[model samples]
Structures are given as structure tokens and as C-alpha cells.
Target chain A: MSIKNEILKIEHLHKAFGENVILKDFDLSVKSGEVIVIIGPSGCGKSTLLRCINGLEDIQSGKIYVDEQPVIQGSKDLYEIRQKIGMVFQSYDLFPHMTVLQNITLAPMKVQKRKKEKVEKEAIELLSRVGLADKKDSFPRQLSGGQKQRVAIVRALCMHPEIMLFDEVTAALDPEMVHEVLQTMLELAQSGKTMLIVTHEMSFARAIADRILFLDEGELIEEAPPEEFFTSPKTDRAKKFLQTFEYSKK
Target chain B: MNWNVIREYLPLYIEALGLTVKIGWLGIILSIALGLVCALILYFKVPLLQVIIKIYIELFRNTPLLVQLFFLYFGLPKLGIRITAQTCGILGLTLIGGSYMTETFRSGLSAIDSIQSESALSLGMKKHQVFFYVILPQAISISIPGFMANIIFLLKETSVFSAISLMDLMFTAKDLIGLEYKTIEALFLLVVFYLIMLLPVSLLGTYIERRVRYAAYGD
Candidate 1:
């Protein structure tokens, strides 16, 4: 655990929709290059947590810091914080109108105002990193689900984000396609990209995560190294959770 | 069956057809602009503009185009501001066409997932950039069919401009009838003129709709 210097910190965060409180007094801190994976049942606010960190959802009350810069609710510009953070959704949400190359180059060229030729060169390099260099001219519709998600990862990486948030990036893939997408993520994690992932893939989580956070119904129930969490979970909820996977596997 | 009269009036009919096409094309362009502005304002839920837009959409959509045309052509003159009949025609079509176009665009905008904007925002893009880059293209793709269909409706509705004496195709037919007493030939040629104008536009709309649908929905 050579982790030092926190990259993200959330304190006393509260989020809700109407009378239904989704997250309450939740807090977390992550160090640079720490691959934190979040596991939870459906509707347990796992995705909500990632969205809050990225400023997709406005927290009811709390403070979030990215490298000590506070993400204030309305006053601070989210663009500054978001530029360093990239998010990939379950659906890929690729801009269908854009070619793979254009999708990768858009935010960098448009928002960052980088020169087109330079950004496009970087985009091509990222596409090759994801093994999709030949698919640059293809529209999203032309790609299979696995290829689309891979391209999506490349699209985010083109922006040169310091941190990445992945919300079930492989959940929608066919069983055969899931591996390809996960392989891209595995390589990304190995490259030391700080990531906060909400996923159901236990095996992948075990392989890459530095720390695993178990959330149950809007509360952090357990946080441990993946080895310890898998072998000896501290809470009954986490035990039952691991049991379900065990039962499913058997 | 008055062939000679129709032949004699060919130039007048052509002139009227040209006027109708000019007014129709200009009005459609203006409406597209107005509709986009109004739709964006409503989509963003601008505090005051939201209520005003709702009233505007409801008002124009509910009432007849004739009433709207007359109001623009005749009603404004009574208020001591006189505009040309042609201006009234274009403005009337723009207002009415704009209302319908707004609704079409609204549906298109709503069809997109809010997550799309969220994704763009999380990528460090500004709100306007999110709109221009992420949302507007998708919205336009989905809205084109509806917008094109509305253009045909707007084209036919230009007949109402004749009420304000703007001398559109319908106006020429009516005038030629009065002069030559060849009502059937005049009216028949008018129908042919409208069909000639409308058929190509309708075909182009269908072609574009198919292409856009394939791009957006992958169907």
C-alpha cells in the first residue's frame, strides 16, 4: 500500500429523490492510482455515488474535493473539475452521429480548445491502444457492443483524464463480448489510472481493485482490500453478499 | 373545359406559383429558426419563457390558421402599424409554422436521454457545448420527419395568405375566375400547381427521414 496523497474526498454527502433518501452522510477518500471498486445490490445508490463525484447529480449537502479543489454546488465551475475526471456509462452513450474518431476527438478539441490535428493524433493513438484504430471511421451503430464500449473507453482517455468513473461498463454486453470490454479496463487499471467503478463482476473486481467498498441501501457497510474482503468480510451483509455469488457459482 | 382561358392565364398562374413558393420557402426557414429558439428555451425551462411558451404553443395550435392570418394582415393595421400584405403573409406563416415546429422539436429533444447531457457535462464540456455537440444533432435527427411533414402543411396553409390579398397561387385562381368566368379551369390548374410543388417536397422528406432514422436509431 504505497498509496499517498488523496485525489478525491467526499464528506457528509447527502442525496435523495423526493422522500426517498438515496445516500446519507456518506464519506470516502481515495488516493492517487487507487482502483476503488464499489459493489452493491440494485438501487442501493452505487451509481449515484459515482455520479455525485463527477457532478452529474447535485448532492443535497456535502463537499467533494478533487485534489483539494472543492466542488461547490452551484458557484464553482464543474468544467474545471470534470476536465480531470472521465465517466463511462453502461450504455456507452456514444454520440451516434459521430464517427469513432470524431467521438474521441470532440471534447478535447471543442471544450479544451486543443488544436484539431494534435487532438486527432492523440485520439488515433488511444484507438490503437484499445485496438480499434481501424474502426475510427465507423459510426457507433456499425460496431458490436464490445467494440462500442471499447471505443467509449478510448473516447474518455482521449481527454487525458486524471481519474475515471465506470458505471457497469460491461453490464450490457453479451457474455462473450464482456471479456473484451473487461480486458480493456484491466489494461487501463494496470496503466495506473485512478478509477472508481460500480460493477457486478466479482472476478474482475478481485483481480484489479486495491480496495473494495460494499454498499447496502445508501450506506457503506464494508471497506477492505479485495483479498481480505473476499476471505473474511467484517459484516454479515457483506458475508451474505459473497454467499450469493458463491451459490450462483456453484 | 375552358382551355383557351387557362392558356391565356398561364403567365399569371406561373407568377402566382412563384410567389407562393417564395413565401412558403421564406416562412419555413423563419419558422425553423424560431422553433429552435423557442424549443431550446422551453427545454432549458427558462422561468418566465416557459409559461409564455406554453401559452404560445397552446394558442396557435388550438386556433385556426385563418384567424391568425387575418389578425396579422388586418388586425395590425388597426393598431396604427401598417405592414405590406406580403409581410403579413410571411409573418403569419412564420408564427403559425413556428408553433408547430416548436412542438416537433420539443418531442425530439425529450426523446434523448438526460444521461447524454450528463455524460457530456462530465467530460468538461460547457452547457452550450453539450447542447451543440451532444443534444442538438440527435434532436434534429429525430425532429426532421415531423418538421418536414409540417412544411407540407405550411405550404398548403399559404393559401390562407390570399385572404390578405398577397396574390399566392390560390389568389391567382380566384382572381382569374372573376375575370374570365372560367372557374373550373382556373381552380384545376391551381390544384396541379400545388401538387407539383408539394409532391417533390414530400418525397424529399421521406428520403431524409429514412436516412436520419438509420443514423440516429440504427434502424
Candidate 2:
């Protein structure tokens, strides 16, 4: 594969909620087809960073670029920017009133103005890809946590985004359900889709992340290749954070 | 004891039942519309209007429905707004029922997970799309039971319309009692007519509530 240019970039991002600063001068660059995993302690601004990139949350001061277009503040055209990025949330926020098929086809049919038949065909294929073909007619509540998360992923994928952001997508699942969601993500990573994942699953991160970003106290403390970050973390906070997983496994 | 009197007054009672149903149905529909508007204004926190809605909800809810009916029926005519008694009854029921409907919808809107809206927005859906397609549907689903309960309550509230001489079921029964002096037969027939009117409404509400829940959970 050829070397790819940056598909997403964030610079000097500052975010705060009610006098409590969440991110300070945060910077990140994501190249096309690169998989980056962000790991940090809870409330360390990991999810906030994902939210900012997608414009789900506003920043105190910063710039986020998707495909060389600057994010327009509170602009109606922001949907143009958002369409290029697909995001899966921690809680798998599928539209409960809709079937799995409806959930997947909603944006395509409504925003993209695609033919319902075409989107339905594409949705079915995507569902089949995620082992959820049988669940196309089912509602979100009918599915288990892992099934719901996988459907959430496919729902984003239906938009044909150039980049995907996963914000601790497996954090809410049962222990047994986590593996299925991780496996679906691993398949997407191997397919060369650019991904930004925020997760605590160290082993999955090690397997997929091109670079692992360690955020601490609202700052990116270290960024390293997954192999090096796991083998010998450069910062004490990263070391201590990793050790919690290590002890749990032991 | 007064079977002959009951038979004689059947047509009048039936006419009154027809008027009551018409007014009750109109009251429920208007209240739902007004309630949704009030709830949406409050939910979006529109400036100036939200406070007005708050006052409207509180003022109507705090006072007695009879006082409101009396004002609309008698006092409004004193101000030269001479509408019919039936119109006054509907307006009265709507004002009171709408207040409770607003509360029901507000609670339902709150029950929705905020992430549902965020997820829709992140998918590139416009603000209105996020509301109509995502937020409103879920909010309505969560609040359907409450909505049904309010409708049933409003249906029963139509009994108060008799005080305004609207010729509703209650008024007809009162007239029958006055004519025949058979209070037991009049009250008995009145209870049966109310049961006939309200049972179908309650059953329909339950059916819709079940479907909404099923759509929400698929179970």
C-alpha cells in the first residue's frame, strides 16, 4: 500500500466544562488507513477528544480538520464534515424505535438521499458482514450488548465514512460479549479502514493500533508504537495505567 | 323502580351522550396539541415563551377546573365573548388537560437518553432531523402511557361540563331526576352510560401502549 496523507488533524484543542478543564492544547494527526488507539484513565479527556473531533462537543479553543476542511463553528454545513466521519459510542445508541435495517439505512436514505432499495441492499450486505444478517428486522432491545455494538458499527459503516471513531465501544458489554465486538473491529482494521479507537483493552490495542496515545490529566503524555508502548512505557502514568490490566490478568 | 321513566328519557340521554362524546374527543385532541406545543417550548427552553408557558401551566394547574369553567362560561360572556356552553366546556377541559399533558410529555422527553440525540447528530443529521427523527420518536414512545392516562382523565373530566348546562350526560341525568323524582334510576343510567363511553377509550389506550412498548423493545 502507498503512503497516505493525513485524513484528520487536531491542533491546540482546549475544552472545558464549567471551570473544569478537560483537554488542554491537545494535538493529533491521523493518516489515511492508520489505526490509532487512545487509552487513558477515566475522565482523562479521552472520550471528550473523540467527541471534539466529530463536533459532538465544542472546544474552548482549537482547530479540527477533516480532509483539509476547517470545522465551521455551529454551521449548518457541519453535517458535510460529519458525514465523512463515522462514530460508535460506548452505549451503542441505536434508535430503539427502528429495526436494525432502519438504523443502518437512516442516514443514507435521509441525508444522502439515496434510493431506499439501494441502501437496503447495502445495509443487508453490511449486516451480513458483521454476522447480523438474521437480525435486520429485529429491534435494538432484542439484541444483546455485543450484538447492539456490532450493529452500531455497521450503522456507521453504512455511511461509507473515510474515518471511524470508536469511543470505548466495548466498555459497557458483558465480558463474553466484548470479544465479538473486538473481533468485528479487528476485521475492520485489517480491511485498511482508518480507525481511531478509545478503549481499555490493552491486548486489542496492541494487536491493532499503529500508535497508542496515552493521555493523562487532560494532556497527551506519550505517543508511541503499540509494541514499544506496551513493552516499555515512557511515562510513569502510562506504566501505572498498564499495570492495572496486568494485575487483573494475573 | 322507575323503569317507565327511564324508557321515556332514553332519547334525551342518548342525545346528551352524543354531545358529551363530541366534546370529550375534541377536548382530548386540542389538549394534546396545545400540550405538545407547551412541552416543546419548555424542552427547547425558548426565551420569554417558556416563562409564559410555565405560568400558563401553573395557573391552570393550581386553580380548580370548576372555577375555570365558570369563568369561561359566565365571566367571559360578561366581557362580551359569548360562545356556546359546549364551547366553554371544551375550552375549560382543554386548558386543564393540556397542563397535565405538558407535564407528562416533559417527563417523557427527559426519560430519553441524551446520547440518542448526540448519536443522531454525529451521523450528520440536521438539528430538525435529530429532533423529528430521533428525539421526538423516542420521547413519544416513552411518554405514550402517560399520554394515554391523561386522555382517560380528560374523558372523565367531561362530567364537570354539566355544571355549565352543556346538556352532557350528567346534565341530562339531572334533568331526568328533576322530571321524574327517581334519583336512583337517573344515577344508575348515568353510571352505565359513562362506563360505555370510557371503557372503549381505556381499551384503545392499552392497545396503543402495548404497541409502543413492543416497538420500543420488540418483545
Candidate 3:
């Protein structure tokens, strides 16, 4: 296997909301085109870790480097650094007042100073890629939950970021709607986009992850290839965690 | 009650209607501009300006427009700050109307979900870009109802301009009554003209509110 360039690195990160510590001494590294899936119980800091990497949350200690540039909260270059990172939220927070094409093209045109025609052309293509070509002129409120999430993914992708972060993107969708979004993500992974995803969709995580990481209580308890991690978790914590999914399936 | 008296005074009332409309809308526009600035200051919590704006909003909102006009028209001159009654009416309306507008806009700004901004910021938008592109449009949409209410309130408040001797609709009605002792005719004309000025605004507000709702929700 060829050694790819590292695109993201985090070391000894600590984050807290007053006395409630969310992430403690966490570290992660991602090479170009790697797809990492983080799985854990609710409140295990999976979301916070992703938020920290994107400079949305202030870190109490340690450093995060994206393409060797430090991700510092409130720093002068945070906006520039953020352009290199794309994030899709669970809420599908599309601008309700804007059409799907406008929502996808806004950041590129306004922030990146890209030409409106070029950005709109790219946005329409991305919308088509997500099976939303006919809906580009539609407002967000006019779309279903699954369609909205796909538009959000296209919105982030328009930035051409170095890495993409998904924070439980499918968790809020209807059960049937979940597959369409997950399928879009699968195609994104197949295209070799570097991604960090936090999800409770165990099967999807297992299928897409280059490596699966098991986190509990703000710490990484286990890390392994998806097949190995699913079959024989290193920690009893992970084993018990995987069992919850089994019980749910029954 | 007296058609001939009303007919004799109709032209004066029409002239007063024009002045009232001009002054009322000028004030409304200025107030909206002032309100938006004050609201942005409060929304961003811009240090000393926020504190100053809070006091200004409280001062104007708590006082009646009548008293504010009196101060600007009557009191200011005693202190050597003489302004035309027209200017006084517009300024006073701007001050009081601005305060209400600020609160209206502030509520609209706060009503937006934090997730909207979080989504924008993560898209690599600068803070101001997030506000102007994402936050402000939604906030303005949310504020429409309150803003229209404020406009009607300010327009009606123009009735108080007569107290400062601006010859608005109310002043014309009173002046006609005093001159000819035809109180019913003059008062009836006053009511008709005020309605003529305000009904369109009310209807327009409803129309705009419906359009904004449809655009936002597709309902």
C-alpha cells in the first residue's frame, strides 16, 4: 500500500463546557482519501471531536493541524482554514429563504469570491450527482427530510474542502430516508474523498470505514479495521456497545 | 352632519393629508433605518454602543410620542436649539419609532435558530458574511409582522404632531372646527382621511406577510 499524505492531525486535545468535560486528551490523524468512522454511545464526545476539528468549538489544550496549518478557534485564519473543511450537520440546516441552488452556491460565491455563473454551474452538477437536479430551483421547505440532507451534503462539497466531516447526518432522517443519504455518502467515499463521520448507523459505518474507532466516556477505547472491530472488539466496553445494536435489530 | 361645511374645508383637509403622509412615511423610513442600526449594535453586543443604544431605546419607548414632540419642538427652542415643526415631528417620530423598531428587530434576530449560523460559519463564511447572507435575511422575514405593526403605530402617532403645530390631519380638523364651529363635519372628515392614509398600509402589510410566509414555507 502506498503511504498517502496526512491531511489532518490532532494531539492531546481537551475541551470542556465549564465543569462538564466533553473531550479529554483526544488525538486523531487522517491521511488523504481516508474514511474514518467514529462510533460510540450518546454523549461519548463524538460530535464534539468533529466540531473541535472544524474550529467550531474552542479547545482547552493541545493542537489540531489541517494540512499542517493550525486550527485555532477565533484565530485570524480560522475562516480560511474552515474553507478547507466541509461539515454537514444532522439538522440539514439549509437556508430556508434560499433555493437549493442558492444555498449550495452562496458560500462559494460570497466567501470564496468565485464567479456566480461558475458556482451555479458547479452547484447544479453536484445537485444532479445527488439526484436533486430537478429540485435546484426548489426552496428547502419544499423538500423532504432526505432531500434536504442531500442538498446540505452538496452544499458542503461545493467548497472543495480537503476533508469532509459528517456529524450524525442520517440520525435525524426518517428510517426509510436514511438509506438514500447513506448511499450518497457511500458514493462520496468511493470517489476517495477524505471523510470523518460520526454515526450510530453501525452497518453503514462498518461498510464505509477504512478504520473504525470505538469511543466511550470521551476516550478512544478501541480502534481496528471494521471487520475486526465488529467481530472482536478489543475492549469489553466496545463489545457491550456493539451488543446494543444487536438487540435493536431483533 | 353639515355637507356644505365639509365641502368648504375639503381642500384644506386634502392639503393636510399630503403633509401628514409625507411626514409620517419619512419618519417611518428614518425610524426603520435607525432601528436596524440599533438592533445590529445590540445583536452583536458592540460594547459602548450597545449600552448607549439600550438607554436610548428605553428613553424613547417609555415616553409618549406627544411628550417627545413637545420636548423637541417646545423645550429645545428654549435651550437655543430651534428646529422647524416639520423637522421636530420627523425627529421625534424617528426617536420613538426607532426604539420600538429596535426591539422588534432584536426579537427577530434572536428568534433564528443557532443552527442556522453554525451551518453558515462551517461553510467558511466570515462572521459578517454569515450575518448578512444567512442571518439577516431570515431575521428580516421574521420581523415583517412586527415591523408592519410599528409602521401603523408610527403613522397613527403622527396625529400627535398637531400638538407641535405641524398642521397634520388632526390639526386641520381641529383648526376647521375652531374656525366654523362645525365639529361633526370636521371630525368626520378627519376620520375619513386618516383611514384613507392607513388602510393601504394595513392591506399591504397583510399582502407582504403572506408573500414572505409563502416564500419561507411554501404554504
Complex DockQ per candidate: 0.62, 0.82, 0.74
Best by DockQ: 2
Q: Considering lDDT, which of the candidate structures 1 and 3 is the better prediction for this target? A: 3
What docking grade applies to model 3? medium
TM-score of 3: 0.94
Which residue segments of model 1 deviate by more than 4 Å? A1-4, A248-250, B178-181, B210-219
Best-to-worst order by TM-score is 2, 3, 1
DockQ of 1: 0.62
Pick out the ten consecutive residues of candidate 1 chain A with the lowest summed lDDT: A241-250
TM-score of each: 0.92, 0.96, 0.94
The superposed Cα distance between candidate 3 and the true structure at residue B128, in angstroms, equals 2.2
User: What's model 2's lDDT at B24?
Assistant: 93
Worst-scoring 10-residue span by lDDT in model 3 chain B? B210-219
Candidate 3: clashing pairs of residues: none
TM-score of chain B of 2: 0.95
User: TM-score winner among the candidates?
Assistant: 2
How well does candidate 3 match the true structure, expressed as C-alpha RMSD?
Answer: 2.1
